[model samples]
Target: MADIRVLIVEDDPFIAMDIESAVADELGDKAELIVVGSVAEALRATASRLSCAFLDIDVIGGKTFDLAAALLQAGTPFAFVSGSSPSDVPKALRQARFLRKPFSTREIATFLLGAISPLKPRRSRNH
Candidate 1:
């Protein structure tokens, strides 16, 4: 399989570390994890190709709605991992997968597996 680049947009250090550890546990050396704390940082990281992303709803800069929309438009697989109610998300994006805060490792692993599954076609990063 090709290398997997995963983006994690989380402001809290501990949560970022937790998500990073989970990504490491799942993909080991096969995955390159980019952990960022703000929407600005995340937007910058979008310059590179990404396999998938885990986004926190509320971050250092603001709500992740814009970031989520961009990822959606890019056809990148992603999940919203946030304490905020799912209803808080924009209506158009509510169909996307969502993982509530205090999630289990298994949940993360499952999402990662699905996101990088061979059956799922990867979108080009040209846009």
Candidate 2:
């Protein structure tokens, strides 16, 4: 859990900062937040570990569904954060979590926290 990395794909500076703070408050040292404002940056960040992700539908590349596709292929859990109820998300991501704009810090935390797996299984030592 201490090595977890959470990605946030948001274009708004203020919103990104708020989400960053919320994630820190929720996961503390258990996870680190990696924020990107565009699909290119998000794609680059994917090269590293991705425990989970929160993607804003309308980013610098127009939207984040393409980035979402990459995440799905990599088996990384993710959710959508949008100011509008976008009708353009891919069918596969329809079941993904959606947090509307103006959402509370608690809601943000809850969405990301829910995606995290429980603690890793302990290794057994044989004598």
Candidate 3:
């Protein structure tokens, strides 16, 4: 719903910023963006009714798939973003939206808007 928020799980500082900018550019003050680099940080941030998530398939210091599973178990919707190929995502996250690296801001923004919108699909085209 409208109360839902976004949580971004990315290990790379640069990538995280990119994701943040994309979301901010589109949503502006419409939603909140929480960025965490590791699994533990993600857990703490995920302790709410998250609208959706933009998660990296591989984190520098933790298992990205674990984070995804935890989010799913918590009943939160999520999308997987990665610099690598689709094969990089764990089996569980394979069903979620897969965003390749070097994605456009418009693509990520659209995905966030669509994901948060109840009537929209959870996935979108690769950018």
Q: Which ten residues in a row have the lowest lDDT in candidate 1?
A: 118-127
Find the candidate with the highest TM-score and give its number.
1
Error of model 1, residue 20, in angstroms = 0.8
Candidate 3 TM-score to native: 0.81
TM-score of each: 0.90, 0.86, 0.81
RMSD of 3: 6.2
lDDT digits (tens) for residues 11-119 of candidate 2 = 9989999988998998787787888999889989999978899899988977788888888888888888888784667788787788888889998888777777453
Candidate 2's C-alpha runs over 4 A off are 119-127
- Residue pairs with backbone overlap in model 1: none
> On TM-score, who's better, 1 or 3?
1
Model 3 lDDT, full chain set: 0.79
Clashing pairs in 3: 5-51
- TM-score order, best first, reads 1, 2, 3
lDDT of each: 0.90, 0.84, 0.79
Candidate 1 per-residue lDDT, tens place, 51-123, comes to 9999999999898888889999998889999999999999999988899999988888899999889734566
- Model 1 TM-score relative to the real fold: 0.90
Number of the top-ranking candidate, with lDDT as the measure: 1
